[model samples]
Target chain A: MLSRNQIKYIQSLHQKKYRQQHGAFLVEGAKSVQEVFQSDFQIEMLVATEAFYKENTRLTDRQRTPVEIASVADLERIGTLESNNAALAVVRTKENLPLLAGPDEIALILDDIRDPGNLGTILRIADWYGVRKILCSETTADVYNPKVISASKGSFTRVNWWYGDVAQFLSQLGDGVAVYGAFLNGEDVHTLPFGTSGYLVMGNESNGIGPAVEPFVIKRVTIPSYGGAESLNVGIATAVLLDNWRRTGNLT
Target chain B: MLSRNQIKYIQSLHQKKYRQQHGAFLVEGAKSVQEVFQSDFQIEMLVATEAFYKENTRLTDRQRTPVEIASVADLERIGTLESNNAALAVVRTKENLPLLAGPDEIALILDDIRDPGNLGTILRIADWYGVRKILCSETTADVYNPKVISASKGSFTRVNWWYGDVAQFLSQLGDGVAVYGAFLNGEDVHTLPFGTSGYLVMGNESNGIGPAVEPFVIKRVTIPSYGGAESLNVGIATAVLLDNWRRTGNLT
Candidate 1:
């Protein structure tokens, strides 16, 4: 049975302030809960339906922390999802990593990407492309948004994210590293000479790269479109751009 | 003013059966409404706030049919959106295209794509890539889903979609066309030599290419992942594959 106060506390985590105060966030759904449980993040509590306990024995057996079996109604009461099912786990937030850049690593820098789903999908792309770090402007969506977490599917565990003023960070990086931006008209992505170590910048959905970040870019790259789309979705464009860079740069 | 009957009529379009029975569908928001007005599709009704009419003279000016200006609250009453937007236009349903394929054109065939957003985004991609037609299995999400209409943005105006059994269609196509399925362990996308004409089959989000569609594929293509992401979002993956094929295939 879930106490009213417990339910209130769980609901509060939906807000960033409450998450910051408690240093934890909710991970719901059986797959997401399992992923969080297996990750290095610290788990605060695990609540599940009786059926969930019986079905997810592997998840329960592997828990190094305390686990609780609750009724479906209790799980539903605390779950952020519209249709509550299997489980919900409260896990401590991952520590914020200091911004780090090396001379020979491919990186992604997001400039005020406001959509949490797009951000999460980008993180998943970065993970797939083997990008170790994604640097975002402070204005970007919170990486912990439940929508972002759900969209990421599990790639958050492998990709490190750091937030700062991207313009300042790019300016400070040494001369050998390349900075690429996706522009409407630029070098054809197929023909661009992508080096192994560089930063690819994707801007806000509506506006392209902001003026502040524009000055630091070494080359503007674009995927040539033959059709009528005004713009590709930020997430889809990210994947296309990254796939090309890795393929042409032979980063893999 | 929207009567109770009128509001119910608009809301019922949310269902596929109602949309089909009425031979029309709702298109929402300023951009989408403007696109439909500019297209050849017949507009059955136009519902908008006074401010929307003031701001978008182009929408009101382009109308060859009767236009209805309702209060924002009236628009809200008949609108399907959560926040309630400025305009909603009901477009006469597009005529089903004849089931025909050219010997040399790229076509996307969705097996069981359930997400409206993915389907809409894919339609936008097809439009952007100059893919003129998309064939959907009857099991795929209805193209008129509000989420689909929103995600497709304005591309639905240009691309043609047909519904049929994807497996049967693939089996009937001659050897000149390359029927490709996106699979996990298939040939690396970068290494594959692709052709201009054929069916590009994308499968269910979680299960991937269905068993029925799998047997009909003459070739299997895979986007090589360099990192730990188990899979890409179906929509993003579709763009990457389509983009690569257009860039490297005989189409170029």
Candidate 2:
């Protein structure tokens, strides 16, 4: 049973303002909550149904955070996911640590990716491809958005994301880092020669890479389109590009 | 200006039952409406703002469909999209034609893809890779769903989808066609050889390829994961597999 204040507080984390103000965000549904419990992030609260609490005796026994046994209805009322019957956790948002890419590491640079779902999916894709760090433009969607957390499917725990001015970050990387941007008429990604380490820049959903960040891009890569669609979804494009990069031995 | 009955009818199409009953679905927003207007699919009715009507004189003049000039507010009120300001069109759903695969075409077979957005993104990816036909399990999300239409970004016009029992259809296809299904522990896709013509089976979001359809899959293929993610999004998986197929000269 959740108190009225607890319900309201959980609901408030749905918005970015409250998330930032409280330095906390929500991880809902069984998979995400379980992953968060095993992660290094600090958990402030855990709300779960009796069935879920009973099923995971290890988790319930070793609980370092406050656990509130609630009904599914209570969990749904306080959570963002429509079908979250298992668990919800309030997790402290981690600070953006300085990410220094090594000479043989591939990092992602996102420019104004507005959709939370897309951002989350990209995080999962980055994690799948062993890309540990993502540099986002300040205008990109909040990494802590509930929608993003839901879409990331627990891979968010392993990936680190930092938001800043994308162009400034790329420009200041100096001469050693290679930068590749996805474009419509760019060189075919399959045929393009990729260095072992670089930053692959992906642009907005509607607009490709923004002009301000174009100068920082040393090479423009494209996924060849054979049919009538205008463009692939941003997340899909990123996954395909990363697959090719990894397959062609571009990532160490 | 939309009549009250027209508005109600448009709103009814939001539900799958009504769309099936009416034999029509909506194409909302500027990009989708424009694309549907140019497609071979017959448009039953088009509602648009005066600005939209005036700008596309060719479409307005050669319109065989009924045109009703409507306000942007009306479009937003009756449409599924939250921010459609330009146009909406009622398009007749096309009949599912018998798809015959030549020796040079690669097609997609989807098993219970429940998310409309994923289905739509799959259609766009299929269109991009020149896969013109898709076979879906009867339990797949309706292709005519407004959410699916919105996510397809006009590629819905180019792709043809058919829904039936996936196993039954594959069983009937006999030994002439190669069937590849994505599995977690399957053969690595990059190292696998794909023929020019075959069926690529994609499965459900949470549950992968169902057991009922598993026997029909002759080849199990998987994208190798280098990082910690357990799986990929269904739509992203489809795009990556298709990219690999096309790049390896498996598609003519």
Candidate 3:
């Protein structure tokens, strides 16, 4: 059962301003909640339905902090979902980290990705491809946005995201770290050196990579399209690039 | 202005039963309505905000039949979106066609894809890749679901989809046509023959390819992971496979 203030607090997180003020955000649904629990992020509060508590006793036993058991109806009242899952949790904001380019690791650099779902999906893609570090333009949607969090589907835990000016970060990268950008016309991904350790950068859905960071790209890669459609979704393009990169053993 | 009955009729198309009964579906938003307007699909009616109708004479000029013009307020009352777009249209459903598979063509076969967004995103991917045909199990989400339509962002006009048993369809295909299924432990996608014309079969988000269709696959492909996560979104996997297939010169 939640008090009026509690409900208001949870609902306030829907907006970025309130989330920033509270220094926390909400994660809903069973799978995401479970993933958050397993992650290092501090779980400020664990709100769960009685049924979820009973079924996930093993998960609860691992909690360093006690979980707050509540009714399904209680969770539903405070949730944004049409049908709230068995659990929801309030997670503290992770510390912001400086964007770091690697000479050996394959990294993903996102330039001005605006959509929350696209950003989240990209994070999940990064997680799947085992690219842990994601450098984002400050204009990119907040990773804690519920839409982004929900779309990431638990991959947020594995991927480290850093928000910074993409242009400045790219210029500072050291030697042997190839910077790859996706463009309409670029070298065929199949022919590019997929085995080398590099930074793969994806751009905005409507606009490709902005001019601010374009000059720093060592190589531009294009996903060859056979159809008449103008472009692929940013998230889809990122996945395609990552898959091709991983496939050819190009990124060391 | 829209009559009460006309508004009710437009709203009824939201339901699958009514959409099927009338053999028409709603295509809203300016770009989608305009795209279908130019396509082969017959336009049943057009409703637009006064500002839109006056400004965009081209779409109205292209209409073979007299288009119904409704006021913004009236359109808003019957619209599905929070803030209605400039225009909306009712389009006749294209006749359901048998799935077409042939030599030297890339195809995508979906097994139990449930999410409207994922299905819609996949359809757009197919359209962008110039994959003309999409085969789906009967359990897949209806293409006309508003969420699916919105997610596809108007690619449905170009992509052809057929619903049937996935296993039966795969079994009937000749040995010369390669059948590739994406899995975690499958052969590395980079080493597989990608450029050749073939069918890429993707499965449900959680469970993956069902057992019934498992044995029919001639090649198993995987998006090799560098991270700790278990899988990529099924839609993302499709884009990855299609892009790699094109990049490898297999499709060209």
**Candidate No. with top DockQ:** 2
In terms of lDDT, which candidate is stronger, 1 or 3? 1
- Put down candidate 1 lDDT per residue, A10-53, tens digits, no spaces: 88888878988998888888777877767777878777887887
lDDT, candidate 2, A153-179, per-residue tens = 999999998888888888788786789
Ranked by DockQ from best down, the candidates are 2, 1, 3
Query: A1-252 in candidate 3: lDDT tens per residue?
Result: 566887899889988999989999989999888898888888877789888877877875676545777777777777766777589888898888885645557888888899998998888888887888998899989999988998898999888988888889888777667889999999877667664577888888888899998999888888777775667899888888887777667434
DockQ category of candidate 3: medium
Give one digit per residue, the lDDT tens place, for model 3 in B1-252.
Answer: 677898899999888889889998888877777777767888888888777777777766676545667766666667675566488888888787777666778888898899988998988888888898999898888888777776788788888888888899888878777888988889876656674677888998889888998999888888777776667888888888777677666534
lDDT measured at residue B44 in model 1 versus the true structure, 0 to 100: 84
Candidate 2 or 1, higher TM-score: 2
iRMSD per model?
Answer: 0.7, 0.6, 1.4
lDDT of 2 by residue, B1-252 (tens): 688999999999999999889899999988898888888888989999989988875874566778899888889889988897799999999886656566888989999999998999999999999999899999999999999999899999999888888788888886868899999989888777788788999999999999999999999999999899999999999999999998887333
Q: Highest TM-score among the candidates is held by which one?
A: 2
Task: Identify the superior model by lDDT, candidate 2 or candidate 3.
Answer: 2
